[model samples]
Target: MKLSPTFLSRIPALFLSCCLLLAFGCSDSQDAVEPTLDMDSKANNKSANMMKEYWVEINPLNHSGVTGQAKLVVEGNVLTVEVWAEGLEAGMPHPQHIHGFVENKGNATCPPPSADVNGDGLIDLGEGVPFYGPVLVSLTPFPTAEDGTIHYKQTFMLGMGDMIAYQALKPLQNRVIVLHGMTVEGTYWPTLPIACGQIMPGNSMGMGNR
Candidate 1:
């Protein structure tokens, strides 16, 4: 084939233009992919910041026959708590609380009958403290049992102290819910631990009574 000098001399420029077009096409494709990756990262961060929920299955302690369930939800700096129980002393105020150890010092749990160190045959508040830790959040304006049942719900804004305690309560499996007050006629009856439940993750469905 015979070609003119002018046409042959322009071949390098034509090749250069094709290379530039390919480079630009590849750059534009990469640029398009980056935004999708960025959007995925943002979506994951939003999910990580969403709300979490926990549940507890309250069981009778000290033979008081009190049983209950509790739900706790955490969203940002807000916490919502709900507790439902029966077999409480009718017409008597029962103080309930979320209990956990500070700084992971000990494992939180529901005290067994063997926790009654004084041979009193009843696990009182002091006896249960070692297993359940100190009261972290007092669920108050303490609910009074109406017709031998208690239904309680409250929401709280995490204050400095509460936030600190909540940080300790992270992985809430080691925390507990304790209901105080019993029908026994005694000086320590009001502070007796009638029901106790360990906090577990997730909703209450299929959770066996403990």
Candidate 2:
């Protein structure tokens, strides 16, 4: 059947209306999806900001000639520690530790030669404690320097006490890393501080600015 001219003329307008409706529907769907994508991006940025890294440059303390570097990474409640050193007492066990002052009592620091209160010519653990504070984390079974060198790495999950100690380390500038043990001939020699370093903030790998 042949359609009337009036009806045929209205058909084009009907088709245009349908096209406009479809276009608007697609735009609304896209608008709804955009916010979800934006939310995901924000979440990712927040996560990246939560992670931090720090470093220390261990230097000889008792003229032992020991030197090393240490890296500390904190992600959530987990911590990773890495230390590399040379010029230690060969084949001897070195007790390494992170030392800090609790509750901001005082600034953590490496003991100077003047710390030898007894005038013993070497800084023992007791003498060094005043400068570096008490041990917060012990990096032990202790690493034995096979050839006057040590390479160590370990990860730890912070417990209540550990987390408290860790919290005190915020703005970690003064926290110290102490490596003990040298070839000196004395009963306290093994506990004597051979090298020390202060922790400082470090650049996060590929995580800065999210």
Instruction: Please tell me which predicted candidate would have the highest TM-score against the true structure.
Output: 1
lDDT of 1 by residue, 76-176 (tens): 44678899999998866566777766545366999977899999787867687778876666676678776989888898754333233233445567788
What stretches of model 2 exceed 4 Å from their correct place? 1-49, 160-165, 186-188, 203-210
In model 2, pairs of residues that clash are none
Deviation (Å) of 151 in candidate 1? 1.2
Candidate 1: the clashing residue pairs are none
Estimate every model's Cα lDDT from 0 to 1. Answer: 0.67, 0.67
Displacement of residue 29 (Cα, Å) in model 2 is 54
TM-score of every model versus the real structure: 0.71, 0.69
